[model samples]
Target chain A: MNNFLTHIGRYILLMRLVFKQPEKKSIYFRQILIEIEHLGLDSVGIVVFISIFMGAVLAIQMAFNLDTPLVPLYTIGYATRQSVVLEFSPTIISLILAGKVGSRISSEIGTMRVTEQIDALEIMGINPATYLIFPKIIAALFFNPILIMISIIVANMGGWLAGSLTGMVPSGEFIYGLKAFFEGYDVFYSLVKSVVFAFLIVSISGYHGYYTRGGALEVGEASTKGVVNSSIAIIIFNLILTNLLLA
Target chain B: MIEAIEISKSFGDNKVLDNVSVKFEAGRCNLVIGQSGSGKTVLMKCLVGLFEIDEGRGIFGEKVLSRMSFDEMKLVRQEIGMLFQGGALFDSMNVEQNVMFPLSMFTEQSIGERLERANFCLSRVNLENVNKLLPSELSGGMKKRVAIARAIAMNPRYLFCDEPNSGLDPHTANVIDNLIKEITEEYGITTVINTHDMNSVIEIGDRVSFIHEGKLWWQGDRDTILMSDNKELNNFVFATKLTRKIKGL
Candidate 1:
């Protein structure tokens, strides 16, 4: 318990340093754009691919379970929409990113730490945390939700296509079900969760990387730990936000 | 000048540096020579604020580095430049970008001005037309030169190089040594290097401090080192068969 608390405290302190004012606003702005390209643009393909499959699988399963004629076909659409919006797009997709983007951030920073690049920055009078980690967090914060929005849209399209192809539900009925009980608040909740998950993923991974010690073996260990920890944090935060906002 | 007074550091129960005091004067190649694990690197790290000293202080000019807050240290660090052992060039950036990084972070100079300064520093290091090349493409000696170019980009008052010639051939090492000496004399910068290479000690060591087992064992210039009577220093300086042959041992 004490070790856990100490880690939490250290993480908070590191966040403080990460948010400190940058030495050069112009350089920081450029870094943010680069990070966005790395974290958001590069990962879109995988997110879209996984989300589409997830939506198709969920729609098929919903259709299979609601095979009775007593159940309305539109209910499949409603269930798919709810599942994608509430959990799959934001939570599961982010959990996937906890392995992809999170591990990359951790390994990148860990390599820099072991190679003395962070120390080089410090010796040059630049704050390593602010210079290296802040832009990543900011980029993730702005881009993860955008990715989730894309995922939600694409996943719905996938479900619609699967419904049509599988003959699980009529196209008209699926469209009606999607539009029948739309809640604007669900989108808001998703965006909130995505933003929180983005923060956790980047910050936690970056912390693990920045404080890495020893050589190549240790860097590898930090990367593994980074992915594991960020995934766990994303799940925990997802539950907390769900309870707070949608319970 | 950069001065360390009674600087001591330890990692948990293991002491790495103990009451080691030294002064590195400007316009000289100050070398800290020691065996591996002798804490020369730790001492240098302490002087540069990379590691905190457990006792005493490091003074850079009129500023007391040990007591300065992180914000306050930035002011002093701005006047500092360092060449890391592996060069530590940002692998993602090309040579020009790596050299111009410090300027971009600290100076309000226009892009054109920063590029021009970077070009000049690159030329000063005898590297030309390789600005767009990545560090992975450069030779080890070239990487060191580029690191030196980056280190001096700010025209730092104090320059620190940790194992600058660690993994270089004798010819390349001598070239690096001469380059450091020429730069120190030309720019009148206080340059401190941590090295275990005897060749570096003999070639460019204007003021050398030898550390043994976390203690300052001996101090002198290159000429005096050849005749020093300290037992540990003699053992270190004459450890090689080639040196013992020259000494008629």
Candidate 2:
């Protein structure tokens, strides 16, 4: 408990340091662009791949279970849509990202720490936290919602393809169910969760990396811890956000 | 000049540096030498403000280190440069970008101007035509030289090196030491080097501070160090067979 509190306190302090104004705006701006490429754009392939397969799997399962005469065939599409938008795309995709982007941030910064690159920055009068972390946060904040939105679109398309190809449900009925009673608020809720999860993944991983103390082995440990901790935070936050936003 | 006045630092219950005080002269190589755990590196880190001292203070030029706020310390640090043992060049950046990094962050120099200055610094280190190479692409000696270029790119008033020649051939180590000595003399930068390498101590140790068991144990230069009668210092100085043979002990 004491160690946990110490970590919390140190994390808060690090956040304060990380959010300071950049020493040079131009340099920071360049770094943000670079981070957007590294952290955000780089994750697109994995996000799209997972979302498409998951959507297809969810539709297939829904069709298999809801094939009774009492249930409407359109129910498959509706269920798939809800599952993709409200849960899978936003929540599961974020968990995947907590592993991908989270590990990258942790290992990169952890390597820097072990190599004394961070100390080099500090001795140069640069705020190492701000110089290294703020750009990642900004890049994630800016691009994560876009990634989630892409996941939503791509996953819905995958559901359509699965229904059409597998003959689980007719195309017209599936499209109608997809468009049926579509709540704009659900998409908004997913976006909100995405932004929050993005913050958690990047900042928590960065914290782990920033405090890394040893060499290559310790860096690997930090990376693993970062992914684990951020994934847990995502799960917990997903529960809270789903309750708050949906209920 | 840089001064460490009775500075002390401890990690948990392990006292790493205990009331260690020393002065580093400008325009000369100030070498701090001791065994592996003698707190030499800790003392350097404390003086550079990477680790806060539990007691005493550091004075950089006329500024009192312990009294300076974060902002004030940053402003003072603009006059400082450091070379880490591992080089610590930004791995993502090529050599040119690495050297120009501090200038881009701290100066209003145009890109062309920054490039010109970086080129000069690189050339001063006797490296050229490798501007596009990554740190991993360079040899260990080349990496150290690039690190030196980056360190001097800012035209710093002070330079600190922690084990500047830790991993290198004896010939390359001599090159690095002489380079550091030349740069120190040319720029009149207050230079502090933390090294256990005897070659460094004998070659360019304009002044030497010996730390033993977390305490400042002795002070002298290369000439006087060989003849010192201090027992611990003698043990350290004569630990190597070559030095033992030279000292006839």
Candidate 3:
């Protein structure tokens, strides 16, 4: 309990430092662009691939479960839409990113720490935290929701294709059901969740990385911890926000 | 000049530096030497504000470093430059970009101006036409030179080098040592170097401090090192058999 509280306190302190005023706007802006490319553009393929498969699998399972005549054929589309918008797109994709993007941030910072690059920055009178982590967090905030939005669109298309091609449900019914109960608030909720999850993923991973000590073995450990901790934080926040917003 | 006045540092239960004080004068290479684990690096880190000193203060000119707030420290640090043991060049940036980094952060100079300064510093370090190469592509000696170029980019009043010649061949190490001495003299910067290499002490150390077991053990110029009666200093200075034979001990 003591250790946990200390980590939480330290994380909050680090966040404060990360968001402090930067020394140079031009340098910070360049860093933000670089981070956006790494965190957002680079992860597009994997997010798309995973979203499509997740949507397909969910649709197939719903079709299998609701086979009886009591259930309408269009219900598969409704179920897939709800699953993608309410949970899968934001939560699962962020969890995936906790493994992908989170680990990279941790390892990169951890390597910098061990190699004394961070100390070099400090000795140069630069706030290393503000210079390194702030841009990454801002980039994640700007880009993660966009990624989630893309994931939602592609996942729905995947569901439509799977239902129509497999003959599990008529294409017309699937499309109709997708449009039948479309609540704009669900999309809004997803965006909200995505932003929060993005903060958790980037900040938690960055905290782990920034505090890393020792050599290569310790850097590897920090990376693992970054992924695991961010993934756990994403799940916890997902549950809390879901309860508060949609209970 | 940089002055450390009774600075002490510890990590948790282990004390690494104990009430150590030393003055590093300008226009000379002030070398701090010790065996491994003797707290040489810790003292340097404390002086650089990378680690908080447990007690006492470091004075850079008239400013007391330990008493300064974050912003004040940043202002003081603008006049400071450091070269790390491993060069610590930004792995993602090319040599030109790495050298220009300090300028970009601290100066309002145009990109052309920054580029010119970067090129000049690189040339001063005897490296030419390799600005496009990444740090990973450079040899160990080249990396050190690039790091030195980057350190002096802002024309700092004070410079610190932590084991600047570690992991280099003796010839390369001598080259780096002489380069440090030349840069210090040319710029008239107060340069403090942390090193265990005796060759560095002999070559460029105008003034030397020896720390042993977290304590300041001796202070003198390199020429007086062989004549010192300090047992710990002798044990360290003449540890090698060749040096012991030369000292007739």
Instruction: Enumerate clash totals for all models, in the order shown.
Output: 0, 0, 0
Q: Tens digits of per-residue lDDT for model 1 on B1-249?
A: 999999899999999999999999999999999999999999999999999889989999889998899899988999998999999999999999999999999888999999999999999999999999999999999999999999999998999999999899999999999999999999999999999999899899999999999999999999999898798998899998988888766
Model 3: what is its DockQ? 0.88
What's the CA error at residue A140 for candidate 2, in Å?
Answer: 0.7
- Say which docking band candidate 2 falls in: high
lDDT by residue for model 2 (A1-247), tens: 9999999999999999999889999889999999999999999999999988888888889999998999998888899999999999988999999999999999999999999999989988999999999999999999999999999988988888898899988999889889988999999999999999999999999999999998999999999999999999999999999889888
What tens-digit string does per-residue lDDT give for candidate 3 at B1-249? 999999889999999999999999999999999999999999998998889999999999988999999889898888988999999999999999999999999999999999999999999999999999999999999999999999999999999999999999999999999999999999899999999999999899899999999999999998999799899999999998998888877
**Rank order (by DockQ, best first):** 1, 2, 3
Q: Which residue pairs show backbone clashes in model 2? A: none
* Per-residue C-alpha lDDT of model 2 across residues B22-64, encoded as one tens digit per residue: 9999999999999999998889888888898899999998999
Model 3: per-residue Cα lDDT over A1-247, one tens digit each: 9999999999999988888899999899999999999999999999999999898888889999999999998999999999999999999999999999999999999999999999889888899999989999999999999999999989988998899889998899988878878899999999999999999888988999999999999999999999999999889999999999999
Q: What share of the true interface contacts does each candidate keep?
A: 0.88, 0.90, 0.86
Q: How far is candidate 2 from the true structure (C-alpha RMSD, Å)?
A: 1.1
Looking at candidate 3 chain B, the ten consecutive residues that score lowest on lDDT are B240-249
Model no. 2, DockQ: 0.88
Q: Docking category for candidate 3?
A: high
Model 2 regions lying over 4 Å from their true place: B245-248
lDDT by residue (A1-247, candidate 1, tens digit) is 9988998999999999988889989899999999999999999999999989888888999999999989899999999999999999999999998999999999999999999999999999999999999999999999999999999998988898899998988999998888988999999999999999999999999999998999999999999999999999998898899999999
